[model samples]
Target chain A: MKRVLIAAALSTTALTATSAAAQTEIEFWHDKTGRLGELLKEQVATFNGMQSDYVVVESQKGNYSEVLNAGIAAFRAGEQPDILLVFEVGTATMMAAEGAIKPVYEVMAEAGADFDADGFIGAVKGYYTTNDGQMLSMPYNSSTPVLWVNRDKLQEAGINPDVDLSTWQNVGDVLDQLKAAGVDCPMTTAWQSWVHLENLSAYHDVPFATKENGFSGTDTELAFNGPVQVQHISTMGEWARDGKFIYAGRRNEGGANFRGGDCALFTESSAGYAGINAEAKFEFEVRPLPYWEGVDGAPMNTIIGGASLWVLAGQTDEEYKGVAEFLNFLSSPEIQAKWHQDTGYLPITSAAGDLTREQGFYDENPGTDIAVIQMTANQPTANSKGLRLGSFDQIRGIIDEELEAVWSGDKTAQAALDSAAERGNALLRRFEQATR
Target chain B: MEKRVRFKGLWLPLLLVMPQLLITAVFFFYPAGQAIWQSLFIPDPFGLSMRYVGLGNFEFLLSDPFYRASFVTTAVFSILVTLVSMGVALYLAVLADRLIKGSGTYRTLLIWPYAVAPAVAGVLWLFMFNTRVGVVTWYLGVLGYDWNHVLNQGEAMGLVVVASAWGRISYNFLFFLAGLQAIPRSVIEAAAIDGARFWTRFRTIVFPLLSPTTFFLLVVNIVYAFFETFGVIHTITSGGPQQATTILVYKVYADGFVGQDLGSSAAQSVILLVIVGILTIIQFKYIERRVHY
Candidate 1:
């Protein structure tokens, strides 16, 4: 009699819990912590409030590289999340992951949503697309390199506050003046290889690698050791020697110095505005990335950084449908515009940009539009589209090591670039061979 | 009589050892075997397909200049870490052994650092010596020494070595202390009464008796330096300033996790396994021969 009573009570509890669990759950793995993490949670809450059929569970999964590692390990264990956020550099690896990911275009089409591929900005969309221009992933947070100037520091150094810094020559003159005026850190840059070499090559309309920067073929060779690249790197090396440029660690380690008002000029992602706006007590300004005037096609559009959302395979059709709906909700003009204005990421769509402009957000935030203009100023050339090389993350490490050598005055700029290119080519060949 | 208790039946003995054998196979042999197997093939990122390239990965690693440089760096790093940690620990143990009161308090205080994780220790040291805003760096600057490890290869290497050794000193200290306490006090007293000074007593009697402990520690410290210092290097220098601190293990991690070159990383792991095996064998052989000393 007692056992039967307990069994009846357990069954009743089970039924109540089942009824409460009606909503399907979708797992989202992202690489945003702190402010971005809170924004992501807010978006998830809004989506959940708007729906009764699904609940999206967002989890912070470390930084970009760590998150990618987690996703790969999870996929290997057959326990991957429904959605994975991958940085721009990992696009080729994800694309080559045949039978692993479901293309975004197909998901939208299957869900019967009014999806327009052309709605996204061309430069942002081109980075994660197939050869025929089919979208592979949804652009989540797009950013481009820009010049960040501490106006207070510049003025303290007795330099003109409105000195034209649109060209490298002008920036050089300013750097000399800052050095002469006893500025400790005249210029420091985050992601030196990205801001100094990669974007520099793109803005000069020079190829960083052959075969359209590996978008057309995997058998591409690094051409970043060309005379234009050599000239720019050697100039930076000279600046480093003269204490006009500070050699910070790789990957945004210099952000602290720049935002702390110790640096007069910083070349970093436009996304830095969110952090700078929150922490910087000094006046700062965002300006266009300077171009080298000697190049024929100087001031070309810069490539994109940040990450995109990929739809992993091996999920139920219902889950995919839910993912499609959630993505559509995220890309809505109001949400995209709010995310752009709040986080300093580029508005992924033209409609979102238009909405943000119509709301007069650009007028209030003057330098926020610099990243968009820098990315969309011209139709992307073959050189400026973006890199799609396999094993590019590893190649970036090699480049970083060589760049550090140059900064330390251990190797000549030309020698370092030549070595970096040679080393990078070996990895590229290995990648090509493996993929084939 | 040989102190041996033979099992009545062989089945009982076999059954008694089965659990341990199963655990060793499951935890150690299985992963090692898998690494060896994977080292011979290159797989796609998704691992949907694999292509066999026998010994190709090993060849590539052997030919890579950075990998070769990492081997030299690892050797230098392990030697420095083992020497520094063991040397400091021996000194501390000797001082504590001489104390008659408050010895337990000293031991307790010294063992506290062992409880801190190696990665956390690395971070602590990095905070003190960071080039831009570190307290130590600022003091050095005031003394006319501009310390910048980001550009200085020697400074970067020294920082990682110190960070790695600092966390290990506590562990080595415990072993050395125990070894010192295990020595019979009578032998030291006789040496002292026979007109020998403190240094003479330690050299003739105490040092000879402690040879076994030192030998054991040599092997243990070498292994600790080789395998356990990755966290310290990762946290502090990240093998930076021209790969000056990039040891073998750090290279393996960078290639496998960051680079996603699984075959190369696997081959590197296999090489490390063989290296460890050889090192253990050499230690055993040498220690056995030197036991009579």
Candidate 2:
């Protein structure tokens, strides 16, 4: 009798929930935190207020790597959400999960949402799209590497605050001056492999790996140990030995050092603006990523970092439609412009960039549009397009270890990169064979 | 002499042990069996297709230089952790056991570190040694000693070992304190009356009787260092400075979750299982022989 009454009560609650609002529930899992998380929540609230057909429930699931791992584990258990935000490095892993994800193009078309593939900036879209130019995921918080200058530190080090750091040569001279002026850490970097190697290759129009950085096929091999990369690494190694370049941990551990006013120069993601702007007491400025002046066609645009939103497969039609509508709302120019302004992420569409410019945001906040201009300034070459390789995340780990050897003076720049390339190639071959 | 009792009905005895048997089969045996099976085959991310290659993954790992280096690292780490944690724990337990009135308070205070999670312990140690803002690092710097674990292999390994061992000391301390209390006080008192010093009494009388607990803790601490310290390594070093602290378990995680290579990870796990099995067998054999001494 008790079980019968419990079942009746549960059924009554369920009926009331459905009858009051027949809202299709879409679970959107992400890894944004702090101000970015608040902004995402605000967007969700706005969407929910705009219409009542669908209620998007957003959940913060750990950091970037944790979220991807959780999404995969959930999919294997057949309990994945309708949408997942995956970091850029996990693009290959997500793409290889056949039948586990629904391409955004198909979701948009099925839902009849107005999504123009051409509206997205080419360089940003190229990273997540197929060979046939189909976008597999929506680029959500794209960022590129840039030089972060602490004006106070530079001035305190007896260097001109308005000095040009547009070239690596000029930056090296300034670093020497800062070191001579008794600055402890003249320069530090976050995401060493990303800023120093990956973006360095792209900014100089060189291939980080073969087969167009693994976009053509799975048989790609590492080519980042070339002369241009070696030169840059050897220079950094010299700086490290001279106590000018401090080697922080692999990821964004140096962000703390830079924000704490201990470092004079930091090469980090443009999304660093949100943090530096918030925590940095000294006057700091975002400058264009430095390039090697010796190389021809140098200072090319950089590739995107950050993450994108992928629509997972196996949800119902109505649920997928809800996901599509949400993404479409997120892609609208007004929302994109606001997200770009708020988070310092790249405006995904040219329209958003133009809108922000028309609103005089660029004039109000100088150097705010540098990332957008950097990404859209040039047609990305075959080498500068982006890397989409299997086992890339692991390969990055190998590269980080080898680079640390150089920083410690245990190995030469060429030797470290060479060893790193060799070790990375073995993993690539294993990945190729595994996915074959 | 050994005494044994036999139940009247076999079915009743089997029924009595059914729950234990069922749990073992579900949790332990099932996963072990799956890992063994998966080691022989490589599956895609979606598990849509699997290619059977018996012993292929094992062969690859055997040839990998980094995998072999991790073995040496794991051995060094496990030994250091066991020795440091147990040695410190034994010393603390002996001290607490000597106290007549405040023994309970000392025991309670010593066991507090056991409550800290391994990851939290690692983060605490990391902050203290962080190159940028660490108070300890800054003090070391002032004393003309540069402490940068990011580039120094030995420092990285040292940091992980200390962090891992710090969390295990409380558990070992609890067991050691209990074992000390269990020893007959009259035996030590009689030795003391005979003009034996404290160290002599502890060495000659107290140490021999506490051998059982010591052996037990050695085995437990070794296993804890092996399988349970991945969180410490992950939070602290992440197996860096050229894989200085990448133990077998850490490698399994790095390859499986970070690299998305399940087959190799499973193969590594199977290898780790065999190592643990041998270690456990050896430990139990030693314990059996020492328990009678």
iRMSD values, candidates in order = 1.2, 1.3
lDDT of 1 by residue, A1-436 (tens): 2243355557778765454366667889999998899998999999999988887888888989888888888888888888999999898888888688999999989989788889999899999888798999999999999999999998998888899999989999999999999999999999888888889989999999999999999999999999999999999999999999998898788999998888999999999989999989999999999998879998899999999999998888888888999999999999999999999999999999999999999999888899999999999999998889888888888899999999888899999999999999998888886778
Task: Name the lDDT of candidate 2.
Answer: 0.91
Cα lDDT tens digits, model 1, B117-204, are 8899999998999878899999999999999988899999889888888878898899889888889999888888889998898888
Off by over 4 Å in 1: A1-22, B1-13
**Predicted complexes: DockQ each:** 0.74, 0.71
Off by over 4 Å in 2: A1-21, B1-9, B193-195
DockQ of candidate 1 (2 decimals): 0.74
Report model 2's TM-score to 2 decimal places. Answer: 0.96
Taken over the whole model, the C-alpha lDDT of each candidate is 0.89, 0.91
* CA lDDT, candidate 1, residue A363: 97
